[model samples]
Target: MTTLLLAAKAAVAVLLLASGGAKLADLAGFAGTVRLFAPARSSGWVVAAVRHAAVMIAAAELMVGAVSLCWPALTWVNLAVLTLTCGFVIAAGLGYARHRGRPCHCFGALTKRGFGLSSLLRAAVVLAAAIASCMPVRPAPQLHFTLVFHLLLLAGAVLMAAAAAAAAKALLTQPDSAGTVA
Candidate 1:
């Protein structure tokens, strides 16, 4: 069970790390796609700030996953990551469903991956893996209560929101290379 958990954690960590790294490196592509989704994409400061901050958040998530893999006992930390990640995927699925066939910048603009049923399925699989991993981690009854689970979720929400907000603020203020609003 521990071995399985470790393997899953490592795989997730690597995947997220790579994906996040790609986005961090290519801000323009991400910004362009986000321009499609973000209501304030037109604001040069907003887009630039958002692009860079999103990259940092992605990197942090990947790094956390990697470290958690090294310490399976830290599996609880994944509860937050998985839940938030699942939420992101589901949201993307909904967008694709409405748009019929939109490219999923979920990985970053660099990948050119599109969103669809496949994307939704992938999210479900990861969500399942995350839940399965927690099962073994909390074999004891009381230790696995909903409160503990929710607390982790709340933390994830706060962190993700904070990061997003910071990114937005930056985008609202940043200037283009020519000192013009991006």
Candidate 2:
């Protein structure tokens, strides 16, 4: 049961970190998606401010997940991560409903390959998983596994962000430059 709990914690951290990192990597795209749902479409400055806020919130999520999972001190991070997941649920639902058949910029290109209800449901479940991690944990002497898991997770996140940037650059460049991006 203790091992199960640890696995759950690790999975939740991975899911949250991935989603948050994806959102943070594409601020303008996420903001544009938010603007579609938001009422502040007319005001240019309002849209920009709202977009930045969304990015900041996503940044908070990425940081919280990393710290809570990788760092030794638990430090109320589980609570913060749970809160972040709940917020993401709200955003995903709202984004889904508002789009009404449009693509979501939530997961960026990652989800574009395949869309599923399970994805959204999994995010909701992750909220519970995060809170569970906050509960009284069993005495597990294997701290090294935890450390290794988190480091690998963090490294994967960095690579994913880099991949997103590369994809975005490729998409933005014109056809004139085949191998070379303008």
Candidate 3:
């Protein structure tokens, strides 16, 4: 049970870290997606606000994932993960209902998968993992991390973020089906 719980925790943490990093790689693209759900027009002050919101959302995901990985014993982190997952669910549903077949950019350019049932299913799985990780387990030996270990974990998180950004940027630079650079 403990092992399962730990795996769930790790899965969600990595998921968030990768997602946040990818979004950061293409802030303008993400803001375009955000505009689909916003009531505000896509001009002037509203555009700037939307871009900032995109940054905050991506930063929140990165911070939450990094903190969760560095301090797994922190029970409150579970709640934070759960909250993010819930937002994912909402996004998936709205994307499907109002913007079906549109690229979600959920993983930036890592995928071109549009919003659909599969997106909802993916969100559901993440939500389930978040919930499972939050389940209480029998008292087990508490795992402790040294300062060096924590630093290593943080380093890994940074690498994951950088990798996602690189991959997304590479994909964006590739030629499209029409053979024109995108």
Candidate 4:
């Protein structure tokens, strides 16, 4: 049971971190997509607000991932994961309903498809994993650091770094309307 919980926790942490890192990589592109769904995009202030909100959401996901990895035993961490998963589910549902064919920008550039049933299903599965991690269990006397666990963490870190680099490169090379990098 402990092993299962640890695996789930690790998986969720990796997912959150990867998603957050991807968003942080190309915040402008992410913000542009966000603006599409926003209720108001008429004013410059509103656009700025949307962009800021996008950054906040990404940062929140990253924080949650870090906390979950560092302290998986805490019930609050599990609850936070569950909450974030639920939010994702809801957001995917709403996006599917309204912006059915638009790119979700979920994994940054990795995922290009628009929100759909698949997106909802993915979120639901994550939510289930989060719930499973929340189930009551006797706390272990000490946290076990297995080879698999270490490998998982390492892989996640590498993926996040790669994604962030790609995003940064894209951001840096993006040309403004004046045909020059901003």
Top model by lDDT, which number? Answer: 3
Regions more than 4 Å wrong, model 4: 142-182
Q: Candidate 3: lDDT over CA atoms?
A: 0.84
Q: Judge candidate 1 at residue 123 and give its lDDT.
A: 72
Residues 1-182, candidate 1: write the lDDT tens digits.
76566466556655555455555545565555555556643677777766765666566665555444434455566775576567667666665676334555555533455666777777777766766666564343422336565466445544543444344334434332232243
lDDT of 2 at 9: 75
Which pairs of residues collide in candidate 3?
none
For model 1 the TM-score comes to 0.61
Candidate 3 error regions (>4 Å): 40-43, 175-182
| lDDT score, candidate 1, position 10 | 51
Model 2: per-residue lDDT, tens digit, 39-61?
74377777777788778866776
lDDT of 3 by residue, 1-182 (tens): 88888888888999899889999998877887777788744568887888898898889899999888877777898899999999999999999999887778788777778789999999999999999988875563344668898899889988988898888887876542222244
Candidate 4 colliding pairs, count: 0
lDDT of 4 at 105: 73
By summed lDDT, which 10 consecutive residues of candidate 2 come out lowest? 172-181
Look at candidate 3 and tell me the lDDT of residue 136: 71
Any runs in candidate 2 off by more than 4 Å, and if so which?
113-119, 140-182
In order of appearance, the predictions have TM-scores of 0.61, 0.72, 0.90, 0.78
Better of 2 and 4 by lDDT: 4
Candidate 2 backbone collisions, by pair:
none
Best by TM-score: 3
